[model samples]
Target: MSVQPDLFDRSLFRIRRHRALKAAKPGADFLLRAVAVDLEERLLLINRTFGTAVDLGGHTGLVTQAIVNAGKAGRVLRADLQVADPNLPLPDLVCDDALLPLGDQSVDLIVSALTLQFVNDLPGTLIQIRRALAPDGFFLATLPGAGTLTELRDSLTRAELEIRGGAAARVLPFADTRDLGSLLQRAGFALPVTDLDTITVRYDTMFALLNDLRAMGATSILKDRSRTPISRRVLFRAAELYAENHSDPDGRIRATFALVTLSGWAPHESQQKPLRPGSAKASLAEALGAKEQKL
Candidate 1:
């Protein structure tokens, strides 16, 4: 089936992501590492070893490293949009996020980290991931959910409206927590589950947050974004608004990052299935000791 129109400038995202990788410091990927840590914890809970795995969008190979360190996967391949910097030790499989280069049922595990939110066709990508997994294989990922950058979004919107009379899309849209589970099911994943973790980061100024976003390759790449760079006047105003509305008692501005963690398995007859209708021996009314009433 066809998917939504391009919401993001995928080419631009790749260019920026490459620049971010080139200019990144040794520990600049702290956020990616944090997500990888959580991914490791989730894998530990499952206690299943994967024979072959793909680390989709494995920025800096942190997720790959986490999986390897945890001994979760026997062999892991890294796939990303750009070749890693030679200075950094990483795999060299450069590929698009939406079009994974893997055969059906080829991989036993797929782990994506903070990557799906940038794809223009997320549903299609998820379906592709599902198709690439072996039966009963696992797909685990974390993407920024709704409310990820509420402070920045609000500040930019208010600043633009007051200064330019209107605002163009300045922030990337994120997946909603409510819709993710259903999306997983639609993508033909079994035992679909989704949960969220909200990380509140404090920045001394709006510029600080923007700097971090740029370094993380998380800057706005909306297809319909303004061609011109943001003006200094609007930017300053946004900083003022952000501080006024989102500052804590200590005067540091709070930025909310809601990470939506998703887990699903490729369908297999061996996996648990829901009970059929009328399969239960006891009625809810009988179990709860309440009278049954006819509607």
Candidate 2:
């Protein structure tokens, strides 16, 4: 069956609003800083070969600044779903979604950090990335992986069940390492690789962690959510449960950030080719027999 194009869900606006509110917080700033550094490194590597690069989801122009400072790329395009501020220093800022606004084979490299997880049609976005890249170009991205924010999720689940007889909306959704690799391959990227890194952070309270998420523009995008405001009683109970169960002896709540980095190249005709079936000199069973004999 042919896949359908995934539309941007309106429910994500709520999550974005919460994250925008939290962006000024220290923890959120720290996380974005680290992500920006990673993006800068990727851009530098790509710049070694290509003169033009694009930074998708370049919020506030941090990565754009890094690219400009590297002085390798002749032109850097900073694009995002929305332009939160028009006064950012980025020279080529464009406000558009990832799947649109880019032309085929127009860019040398496409770098996106901490952006793909919010996309409902991740495969489509990747395909678009491939289309936007020049021949033999590179695409690099970083996204939250499974196991991120588990502490917050667990605490919220427990509190909601105790108070309202069910769980609250899921705050985040992330792809696993293997699945991300498959996605890159499915999107027609060559030499796809995915690596996972875990970052553990301690917060003074669960509320602090939530605030950071809000600042980072990371939140739930549930479509059928209740419009009623969250009650203070529920919030306090959730905090108490989180502190009691998920806190360390130092009285800090813990949260894990699972970062996944993916890199791939646009396919080229000069690259090595895969062997056809029955092309190998030895069969798998023969190879196993040889190994057994060696033992």
Per-residue lDDT for 67-144 in model 2, tens only? 677665778888755544333554465445444577899898777777778776788889988988888888888889
Please estimate how well model 2 matches the true structure, expressed as its whole-model Cα lDDT.
0.75
Clashing pairs in 1: none
- The TM-score measured for candidate 2 stands at 0.85
Residues 163-215 of candidate 1: C-alpha lDDT, one tens digit per residue: 99999889888889979988999999999999999999898999988999998
Candidate 1 Cα errors over 4 Å, as ranges: 1-3, 90-92, 289-295
TM-score of every candidate? 0.95, 0.85
Pairing residues by index, what is the TM-score of model 1?
A: 0.95
Root-mean-square deviation per candidate: 1.8, 3.8
